[model samples]
Target chain A: MTKEELKIKIEDILPAATFDETGEWLNILIEAKAWYGFAKQIRSSRELEFDYLFCLTCIDWKTHLTMVYHFTSTYRRHTIVIKSKLDRNNPEIESVAAIWRTAEFHEREVYELFGVKFLNHPDMRKLLLTDDWSGGFPLRKDFEDPINMIRL
Target chain B: MIEEVGTTTEGDLIINIGPQHPSTHGVLHLVITLNGETIKNVEPHLGYIHRSIEKMCESLTYRQFIYVTSRMDYLSAHINNHGCALCVEKGLQIEVPPRAQVIRVLMDELTRLASHQLWWGAMGMDVGALTPFFHAFREREMINEIMEETCGARLTMNYMVPGGVMFDLHPNFQHRVKKFIEFFKSKIDEYHELLTGNMIFVNRMKGVGFLSKEDAISYGCTGPTARGSGVICDIRKLYPYEVYSQISFEEVIETGGDCLSRYLVRMEEMRQSLSIIEQLIDNIPEGDFQAKTKAVLKLPKGEFYSRVETARGEFGVYIISEGGTTPYRIKFRSPGFSNLSALNHMAKRSKIGDLIAIMGTLDLVIPDIDR
Candidate 1:
């Protein structure tokens, strides 16, 4: 399916979801509270059984955090971009690691780099970063470290 | 602390496999917790060659970043360059000239051949066969000469650029490639004679490191690793990019899902790549090499993800842009990462020697894993 048709279909299914159609992919912004249910529906629904959660990462927008999930269906050969906003103060979201096994490592990486907590993550410990890392979320725009010279 | 230490009896021998061992291949130190040759657990300690390329890409222009990716998987540098060029082209929405696309495909095929040759040799050495190593390098040297003449670098060519390739095909590219093909055709039988049909090689690989199809998918194993398990996950076929849609080549699937099967898949894949190169060599079109684009590339606020079938598996690049020259967030979904994930699953029940064979069949370049 084309990005336009996918965007319209998503909006029809989830009326409250915001759509960004400018990019190469069909980006649908959803509320944090609805992320888990939306992910489950997207995975199992006949129209969009996005069985492949290929790439998952978090962006530190300073004021808020955005969790991006890049989904593609092997059977349908269609792609969808799902985004959910988290409060910058205490970023947290339901883990989709259970839905897509590939999400496990990516989520751990996001948790450590962006400080976005996965609510039901089985093992949310640091995957790449060290245990001694005490600086506030490294990827955040506001994150400043004299030691690392990280000035965004 | 003393009481806790007493309570926590060291049940297994903790052995550090390498930070500098020849077999581990580039500073990969595997902390194996073993119970009498049976691996209870394997903790891979990485970051020895972490040059922070992703972070460094923030400072480099789109053209310069192509060279950085070369270092990630040095053996398959052409594939990596193809990936980054495709991403930048997608961002710019520029169409590559037909000649450039054909050249890109040819380079990619040669790179695949070179990569598999190195793997064939290294994997043979890993299994304690040294003669095949020299034989494989003998063929690989021809491909290296072809790359060096055109791209100016043998290992990290950095030949590919956004919109198209760095330069037009060298005068001797076709001649050298054709000569290599003819040479490879005559030498192909040597591989079967020396390695594939050998009794020792078969025994070492046949039943070792068995990974079932379901487990292969769950762990995200790709390329030859997943293909060995009968999984059809070739990115070139699924998402046809470049002139790949116009070409005909087998996906090369095997059902054995063992070390031997993986070895067979790569060997077959090399032949398939060679055939693709042969068909496309003389049909090179005449046109501009690179499409016009602005000096500074600022990808609008959006996200782009590209997946390419690398020598080992699917190499994915995820870039998040915030209307800036530098990417907001960049992540590489390396094929080696998932392949490495299956190690504990594949190596747990095997002996120490079989463990080395399993690792070799996986064809891991440690920097790719750590990145």
Candidate 2:
């Protein structure tokens, strides 16, 4: 199925979700409260299995954080992009690591780098960063490290 | 003396297999808890070669970041470059010309063949078969030469650009590729004669490191590692990219899920990749080599995810753009991460000697894992 068809199908299921057609895959922006339920439905729905949670990551957008989940159904050969806006101060969400096993490490990575908490994650430890990393959320737009400087 | 000899209790022997050892391959330290000859547990300690490629990509322009990915999986550098280029193209909404797509496919297949050749040699050496190492390297050298002639550097050839390739196919590309294929075909019989049918090699690998299909999928193993367990999860076949849709090839699958099965699958995959290159070499398409795009690329404020089938398995590059030349965020979903996850599951019931063979068959390149 094309990105347009996937978008329409997702919108039909969850009316409140917003979408951006500019990116490569179909990007559907969902409210934080609706994310968990929509994810479960998407997984169990026969029309869209989305069995593979290939990539799950978080982007810190200065003002707020955006949680991105890249889903693909091996059976249906379709791709969907799910995003949820999170409060920049204390981002938290229910972990989907239980549903798709591949999300275990990815969720932990998001938790560490963006300071987003995966509520039920089995093991949420620092993945790529060190224990003494004092730089707050390195990927955020506002982050600055004088130790690691750059030339303009 | 009698008490010491007869009344002794057996304790597990702990052995550090790497972080510097030759067989561990690239700064990987495997702490093996052994009960005599049997392995009780194998714990992998990583992060030695972590250069923070993802973190580095945030600072580089979209064009410059492709070179950084080349360093991740150094063996299949062309495939890595192809993947990053494809993601950038997707992000920028650029359409590559048909000829460029075909050339990309050709380079990808050659990279696959070269990677499998190195795997074959290294795997054989891991299982105490040394001669196949030279044989494998002999064939791999041809591929390296071909890559160097076109892309300049052998291992980390950043040949792929966003709109198209760095350059068109070399004038002698077709001729050299055809020669390599014929040469590889003639050497296939020698591979079988020397190693595949050898009695000693079979005994060492057969029935070792068995992973059931259910465990393989649940753990998210991919590439030949998962295919060895009868899982048909080839990203090239399932999610056709570039010119893979145009060509026909078999996804080699074996049900044994042992060291021998993994070995045979990689061998068969090498043959299939050669077949693909043979089919693509003669029919060079005539068109523009690259797509037209702006000098400075500005991706719309959003997220883009691209999954390409690497030599390992499903390799994903997720890019988040915030209307800037440099990506706001980039994440690499490496195949080795999942493949490495299955190691403890596969090695729990195996012997110490079999651990090397198991690790070999998984084909875990440490930099890719640490990245």
Candidate 3:
């Protein structure tokens, strides 16, 4: 299906979701509250079975965190990007790992690097970093580290 | 490393295999929970070699960042660089010349052949046959020489730039590739005879590491790993980039969903790569190899994504450019990371020896997974 067809179908399911038309793929901006439900539909719906969660990442925009999801339908061969904004102070959102198994590891990576809490993530722990790592979310815009460390 | 290799809950023996074993391949630490001989869980501890490439790319410009990807999938380095260049090109709206397109496809297939050769040899060694390891590298060394001749590098060839390739093909590029194809084509039968048909090897691989189609998709497996399960996840056929659409090649699917199936998929893929190179070796178009672009490349503020089918699987480069020389955010959807996540699912209930067969067929380069 084309982007326009998919856009209309998404609009039918989500009336309040807005879209940004500047990017290559169809960009849908949905609220954090509606994200979990809309994402479930995005995967299970017949017309838009976005079974493949190719990329799930968070962009630290300083003031807020924008969660970006890149989804592709293995059957339909169409792709869409879903972006949701969360509060900078307490960034938390419903986890989609249950819907897409690929999201499990991805969500863990985001949680450790971006410090964005993925609600109900089965094993929410440090993935690439050690448990004793005290550096404040290395991928965040404000993260800083000294040039040389005296202690390991 | 196995400080505690004792019986866990319900008499399952928990054993940790290498953050440094030869067969595990590149710093992958698999903590397997075993009940006698069958595996109950395989938890992989990654990031030992993780240089935080994504964190590093945030500071580098679009042009310089492509080389970092070469280090990720070192075996399929050319294809990794191609995916990044394709993403940057999409954002810049630069049209790559037909000659460069053909050359890019040619180099990609060559890299795939080299990677599969190494996998075949290494996998054979993993399954207790050391002879094929020597035989596999014999063919691969030729391809490495071809790459060195043109790209001036053996393994990590950052031959591709944003608009086009860094330089034109060497004077003997076509001839060398043609000779290599002919030489390698004759060796494929010997490969089947030496390893593929061996009952001992077949017994170890067949019916081991079974991953169903539904599980393959759920785990987001791509490339030959997913294709081994009869999943049509080939980016070349599904979303053809560059001259892949122009070329005629099979997707190469196997429904076995076992170690043997994944093994056969890559083995057949080597033959397919030879066929692809044979078709394009004689017909490279005459044109500028690299397109003209400004010294400083600044992609307009937008999000662009490009995916290429590497030897392992689909490598997607997602770039969010805020109208700057350096990318605002760059995320590489590496294939090995997701494929490795499904290792536990594939290895469950399988014997300890079968775990080696499963990991071998997956053909993982540890740095790729770590990145």
Clashes of each: 0, 0, 0
Where model 3 places Cα greater than 4 Å from the true spot, the runs are: A147-152, B1-5
Q: Residue by residue across B1-371, what tens digits does model 2's lDDT show?
A: 01121212457677777778767777887767778778787766666787667777898998888888988988777888888888888877899998888888888888988888888888889888899999999999999999889888889888888988888888988899999998999787788789989998999899999998866766678899999999888988987998888788999999999989988898888888888888888887998888888888887776666778889888888887888999888888888887887787799978888888899999989889877
| Chain B TM for prediction 1 | 0.96
CA lDDT of A48 in candidate 1? 83
lDDT of each: 0.82, 0.82, 0.90
Pairwise lDDT winner, candidates 1 and 3: 3
User: Evaluated on chain B only, what are the TM-scores of all the candidate structures, in order?
Assistant: 0.96, 0.96, 0.98
lDDT of 3 by residue, B1-371 (tens): 24568986588889888888988988998889988898989988888888778878888888899999999999999999999999989988899999999999999999999999999999999999999999999999999999999999999999999989999999998988888887888899999999999999999998999998888998999988999999999889888888888888898999989989998999899988999999898899999999999899999987888999999998989888789988888888899999998999899988898889899999999899888
Q: What is the lDDT of residue B46 in candidate 2?
A: 62
Model 2 whole-model lDDT (C-alpha atoms): 0.82
List DockQ for all candidates.
0.35, 0.28, 0.51
How close to the true structure is residue B162 of candidate 1, measured as C-alpha lDDT?
87
Candidate 1 clashing pairs, residues 3+ apart or interchain: none
Least accurate 10 contiguous residues by lDDT in model 1 chain B: B1-10
lDDT for position B27 in model 2: 85
Off-target runs (Cα >4 Å) in candidate 2 are A1-47, A131-136, A145-152, B1-15, B32-41
Model 3, global lDDT:
0.90
